[model samples]
Target: MNNTLKVSKYLFRDFKNALLIFYGIILAIAVLMAALFLNVISQESGNASFGGFGFSAFIFLFVSGLNCFKANFKFLQANNISRKRFYYANIITLLSISAFMALIDASMTKVLKLIMPYEDIVEQLYKNDLFFSSFIWSFALFTLAASAGWCITMLYYKCDKLMKTIISFAPVLLVILLVMLNNVTEGALGISIIKSLTVVLGFTNNNPYTAALSFLVATAGVLGLCYLLIRRIAIKD
Candidate 1:
């Protein structure tokens, strides 16, 4: 546990500056976007919707995957850090970041609401009216997306030239496959999958906990696979 904490501390310190800078930039962008929305209000328009959370989620996920997960491995290997300790630290760090991001997200919503009490343009797609619910689901998404990014990057590192080539085409192939499946079945597979997920998670799209629960489940699976792949991964020069 002590070692895990140490690992987590080290990982956090390593990226703290970069992460802060990134967030600072994002904050500036959000404020600008909020101002833009306000401008629309000045014109007596009715488009009080803010999808900044989408951008927030993507940044949190991809940045954590690349900087927090993938980059840390190099330093850990050089410092002779234990794989087990690093793994624990990874979980801790990811959860912390996810929680923090969720806080920022919810906070922004509140800030916008406070600044423009009558403005309904600052929209949050997550239908939860409560801050806690919003935070829970946001954390779920952040951690899950980061975990997925970690797994995908790990796979890239572990792949051969041929494997990398195959991976490059995997997305296209996947889309084609799904299209064919949809055509053959004459069913809306994507909608069906979403419905199934909503049912399994015991929450609706409007429910704050819906995707959050599913994300947790999927994150666990992805993290397990990541651990297996990275456990014996060689430290590159």
Candidate 2:
């Protein structure tokens, strides 16, 4: 447990500069977009909506997750840190980071909305959710994105060239297979999948809490797969 704490501390320390850099870029983008929107608002009559800012946060964390494992894993292994400790540290670090970012983003969104007609995709979809629920939803989404990236990275790390190729094409193959299945079932499969997603995502009921729960569940499933792949992964130079 002490080793895990040390490792988690190291991970958090290592992420500090990267996090600053990431938010710096986001700040610049937000400034530019706000300026552009302000100019447009000057010429317009009513409220103008700005979106896609929240998505940048997700992309940053997802890409961070994709790159987080290899170098750190190599360094920790060289220093005799066990894989279990490393993984635990990552879980701790990711959860903390996700929560922190989510809080920042939720606050930013509230501030932006107050200053301008800013609405994130979630706000547009969920429509009038409470601040706490929005924060939870954002946290769940950020964690899910990071976990997915980690899972994909671990899979690529564990696979050989041929398996990597297959994995690379797996999404396309899955889409093709889904299309065939849908056609065979005369769109019933697609409809059923969409309906299921709508229910699980709370679109039918317009509940962010349900969607947050689904995202958390999906994140857990992805992380579980990541652990399975990471446990016996062969280190590559």
Candidate 3:
């Protein structure tokens, strides 16, 4: 088999085994949440609501992608694949999963709309001015999370257990620090800094192209750092 085909097959097999299991659990939780929220909406507004459940499901799938990446990385290494091929395969697999999950989310929203008598909730979701923006943000967040997982896996591959534990928690700590700063500054400093930086970079108008370019640059920089670290520090057993 050719290298691409080999990687593709390996990617598919691992994804089938791991992603499916995680997806099934997520689907079940989503359905249950939808059912429960439907009752609450019906009681409060005399109409069923599926929005909460749908949103929860979406969040679950986004979070689950990290676990999928971790599982796939271990499987690829066990199967004797090179780290480069493993990384490429992981990126491909993650994109495919994200696309599929997005489609599923859309489909569920449609189905919920059909079953529920409440047009108000559905209309709010479909017609909100920030709907598209929120969708794009969700996609960006997923990419960030997946990339973070890959980076953590690399750290684990390169470092001792103690080092891996510290490295793994670094992102969490950074997030906490950001939240604390935001709270302390009453959210002004962070927002001002981001806006100022965006304006300086000529991205203040929120052009989709510019935002996408920024995202690509940031993702590339992260992946590059991961590559360098893994190349230099990874233990080849």
Clash number by candidate, in order: 3, 0, 0
How would you encode candidate 2's per-residue C-alpha lDDT over 135-189 as one tens digit per residue? 8988999999888887788888888899999999999999999999999999999
| Ranked candidates, highest lDDT first | 2, 1, 3
Please state every model's RMSD to the true fold in angstroms.
3.1, 1.6, 5.5
Give stretches of model 3 more than 4 Å off.
26-44, 47-80, 117-139, 165-188, 193-217, 232-237
- Give the TM-score of each candidate: 0.85, 0.94, 0.63
Highest lDDT: which candidate? 2
Q: Any idea what lDDT model 3 has?
A: 0.57
State the displacement of the C-alpha of residue 227, model 3, in Å, after optimal TM-score superposition.
2.6
> Candidate 2, which ten residues in sequence have the lowest lDDT sum?
40-49
The residue-by-residue lDDT of candidate 1 on 66-129, one tens digit each, is 6565568888877889777888788888888778877887677677666543221113443445
- Global Cα lDDT for candidate 1: 0.73
Which of 1 and 3 is the better model by TM-score? 1
Identify the runs in model 1 with alpha carbons over 4 angstroms from their true place. Answer: 33-40, 117-126, 188-191, 197-205
Q: Is candidate 2 or candidate 3 better by lDDT?
A: 2
Residue 146 Cα positional deviation in candidate 2, in Å, after optimal superposition: 0.5
User: Per-residue CA lDDT of candidate 3, range 1-237, in tens?
Assistant: 766557766666755755577668766866666666566766687544344433443455445544554455556667766767766666666556655554555555555555554222223433432334434433443455556556655666667889888877998999999889999999987998788768643355644334444555666776777777655444355
Of 1 and 3, the candidate ahead on lDDT is 1
